[model samples]
Target chain A: MTARAAMGVLLASLAGGAGYADELLPYRIEGNAVPVSLTGKPGDAARGRTIVTNRTLGLCLLCHSGPFPEERFQGNLAPDMRGAGTRWSTGELRLRMVDSHRLNPDTIMPAYYMIDGLNLVAPAFRGKPLLTAEQIEDVVAFLATLRD
Target chain B: MKRFHALMCAVVLAAVAGPAGSADIPLDQRRSGYADLGRDTKAMQDDDTSNPASLGVQDGEALWSQKAGTAGKACAECHGDAAASMKGVAARYPAFSPARKGPIDLEQRINLCRTENQKAEPLAFESRELLALTAYIGRQSRGMPIVQSDARLTSAIDAGRKLFTQRIGQISLSCAQCHDDNWGKQLASSLVPQGHPTGYPIYRLEWQSLGSLQRRLRNCMIGMRAEPYAYGAPESVELELYLMWRARGLTVETPGVRP
Candidate 1:
């Protein structure tokens, strides 16, 4: 493809993909607002791992240590997540992933489904949550299965 | 841009010009407080670096010296000798790049070199390669002054300064709160410095490898319970520039051993 054409294609792709993901995970963010969805299937640990490792899914291993078939991909920044289930209760894990500040207040973790509202952000994220209710539940289910 | 400027104007107006007496601590204790904090920080620096984490630094050194990629430009080619070549490089970064026309920290600069010069894919922020490269690069300026400055950096400096003072994390602790308001305060076992940018690209004993300024900022954001700026994003660059300015007088300690 010509350079100009490629540039056009890239721009078009970006424009098209801009907020489409939100269609499936409809949510918003307003300054410091938290997004919590009390909904979804409790994910199977095995299935959750697939999503966690999936490049388009949770992508948790990007900054977290975890036991997975993909050993080469684990990050060393945090403690190994292999035995997380042994340490944290399911409720604790859910809260930590969903919005860690509720627990530690000083944690650097993002509000998965919650939007730590940015009043100056945009109208779309002004008062909405970040993760859709369903994605939060899916991620929660996945986190629950991190035993061993 | 206008709104952001307006926000900045308000912030600058609200800034307490000079250091104020500590509201929480006793008056006399506040005087020697910073000095005592320094001692505590030095103590925390005594990490057991003789472990797996230290191994990452060795790998980074190897990677820094290795000549791979299509252009055959190992970092050594342009950077020259790692030990002598990178002196004071890390501290001056998050500064404006004439070529890129924006502020870029050392990690992004390295990635730009890799992708454009080496013809390689950019490493992810948390990747081992990025960590190793950061460590090796930092090692080059172990004892130099951070000394970041440029006339073209006014706007970036302003933006970064705003970011440093703005409280965004769920914990509501701005960079200023810890590094400015309580530079010598103890947060658990750790003593907070003025958030100096010295010894960057240094081998952090905790991660057991070298990390870039952006990585450190991201970690700080996590520590503050804030959403991290994405790797290589403009916000991160702006923040980096501000940090460089904040640590202006500190010497560069790139690739230094840290606990």
Candidate 2:
């Protein structure tokens, strides 16, 4: 199996061992724990890049320095993400990108998943998710490639 | 003629009572169904029940009594019993200080005292010691009038007034929009009070700690999606001065607890 496929199998086996019956469920069960779902294939670099720059997508550069050479007006709120793949394992990067707030309670970052604990000012927007499942997977794939 | 004096007294009383009664105006009128100034007032009026001092007050009291730094002078040495010496002190802050050549709010004054009187290091803004001492000193003036005034300070006051009125940030809502125009309106889960300065340096339950007027102002700016002024920045000082002026005559409620 490819590294990506191996990781997926490991995750699936872990989920099975943990008795999470909904491991392969297509539909998402969002709440305080399921912020966003993922369905992107590995190596989708072009789509990942699109998500990073898309204002409605990742918007990662808004608060961090990234290797997007053409982008300007980025904020220095978080650490530079130019070499994220070298700095963190795929699993660690996955967790951090998913919800950096969980690691540092005082961090200003938002959780991409586990949505139930958010503060929604307007009721019309309540219970609605932030990012879609495929978008998260694509973004992760893009982040995993930033080794050099 | 005697009735005129009584009428004047009533007016003065009404003016003094303005801040407390009107503090929660915005939340009541908004669509959120979140706030009620009347309830807040009722809770405030029953101070023994609602106004339990926060940890900041306790820390401040310790700092006030403790001798620190080179001068070997505790705040008690120069101020001589905070309850008596410091009473009404805060009510007069955000006033003109010729040395500063502009405005001197409570935070600046605290730093000044730390440097000049206590001969200690100036506490940084939002520092535990600073917040504590500020809370303690403010508690001394609880129930006194917020009485800032000056002619030379008009420029700063004007700047502050503009800030209060001007809308900034992504939300495009000015302080006046909620506090003045649509007070008693609901936002979400909370009430937007009339933007009174009465219960300042209050311990907000949401914050889980005591915070100064500047802290509250920053939070509001963030809510408006506006860039926050740095702590101790001139804009924040100007804004605070204006708030003090707007909230004049209202009794101070330092070390106050709020939701």
Fnat: each model in turn: 0.00, 0.00
lDDT, candidate 1, equals: 0.60
Q: Where in model 2 is the C-alpha error above 4 Å?
A: A1-148, B1-52
Error of 1 at A119 (Å): 5.7
Give the CA lDDT, 0 to 100, for residue B147 in model 2.
73
Which portions of model 1 miss their true places by more than 4 Å? A1-148, B1-54, B188-190, B202-210, B256-259
lDDT of each: 0.60, 0.65
- In angstroms, give how far residue A14 of model 1 lies from its true place: 36
TM-score for each prediction? 0.53, 0.55
At residue A105, what lDDT does model 1 achieve? 51
State the lDDT of candidate 1 residue by residue for B104-196, as single tens digits: 877787888888889988888868888777766666665565565464666677677777766564344567666666655444345555666
Scored against the true structure, residue A20 in model 1 reaches a CA lDDT of 31
